[model samples]
Target: MNSHTAFVAAMIAAGMFVLLLGTFYFGNFRRQKPALWRYVADIDRAGAMIRRKEYDEAEALLAPLASKSDAPLHIYQLRAAIAQHKGDWVVAARHWKAARRYFPDDALGFAGGARVLLRAGRRAEAVRMLEGARSRVHNPSQLTKVLAEAAQSAGDWAEGARLWEQVRNEAAGDIDSYVRGHDCLLAAGRPDEAAAVLADGAMRFPRDPQIVRAVAAAAPPGAPGPA
Candidate 1:
């Protein structure tokens, strides 16, 4: 064929392919859009019900959604929340574990499970659970912070100090990290490390009264005062 005729045919074929793609995309989107909205709306309603202390209704509302083959991760979270509020630690743990099992790459399940365990005063278990899932969760600093707190609560001061330092390394701007890390270090009988943490926090947050006080307290009896 001549170049002109060949070019025209190619252009028409490209146009048809583009039209086909657009038609399929928009048609699929239109079909799924309403279901997406309803799914979100139901999740919101269930969340509100849980917030209002309507555990039974929240559970009922979430049950059908959870039964669906492609149920969202939120369903398990909501169910766990309801179980937690009702003081059913066993059920809460189960749902949170299910969330982790179903959504391995998400941090919410592991973090939420650790939170529930912390609330139930199972500090060591909470730490262990989060530690095991450390490699799976994305952006695991938040879980690291939780583990730090859990270690502190369990009186595992050495572990707490290590985890808190990890948190501080991940997020230098987190004031709690410096304060908690320093405290845990002190509790673990590491005076030098504690002093170092306090000094760093004092330098970064010079005006923060907590860190300022910590620095003053850590100073030697004959040392020069803050100027």
Candidate 2:
């Protein structure tokens, strides 16, 4: 063909070559989304194993995903649960901590760690772990009492009082809050506050034998009820 026709053909060929080269380079050089579907499915299988109480097998399945950058956060959680099942508190504690480390903003991680600490009898640490996590904790009403008890156990009576009051408000007529709050105040050498809690309990629950007994039991000789 003529010079112009030949030049046009060369240009078309060059364009096609460039297009194919980029496609091949990207296909090989650039990492594609790793196929995480199988990892997710395996994680689910591990969960089933945990439910069946086959901790060893569950752990084996979870080992691969535990440190995988793209793995779901539940992998470490399941690992922690398995460790807890096996009664390895140390391992469980670290795994729970790792879960939180991987997801700083995740409530599940903090809750998991706090739960493990509670089970390990590290009451003070558990309460401290829960301090920042209380708002994010699941089932706040139930957890409020747990954290309050932990605070009381740790002798942080002010924190204990606050947590118990939170539970009392959320639970709406749970006598345990008033009773336990009174006990915590006594532990902290605050008899006046203790009496006030008991008096409140008696006011709210006039017929509750437990509150009446507590207030009477706490009253000084001949001082009358909750004066």
Model 1 lDDT per residue over 1-227, tens place: 99999999999999999999987876653321224455898899998998899999999999888766457787888899899899898898899888887677777788888888788778778878888888887767878888888888879999999999999888788888888898999999998899888888988999987777777877789988787
Q: RMSD, each candidate, Å? A: 6.7, 11.5
Q: How close is candidate 2 to the true structure, as a TM-score?
A: 0.49
lDDT digits (tens) for residues 1-227 of candidate 2: 99999999999999999999987775565423345675878878988998999999999988876655556667778899899889897898888787666555556677777777887788778767777666664545655677877777778888898888898888768888999888887887888888888888888998887887777787779877643
- For each candidate in the order shown, give its overall lDDT on alpha carbons: 0.83, 0.78
The parts of candidate 1 lying over 4 Å away from their true place are 1-38, 114-128, 171-176, 189-227
Estimate the lDDT of model 2: 0.78
Worst 10 residues of 1 by lDDT: 28-37
- Candidate 2: 10-residue stretch with minimal lDDT: 26-35
Clashes of each: 0, 0
Instruction: Please tell me which predicted candidate would have the highest TM-score against the true structure.
Output: 1
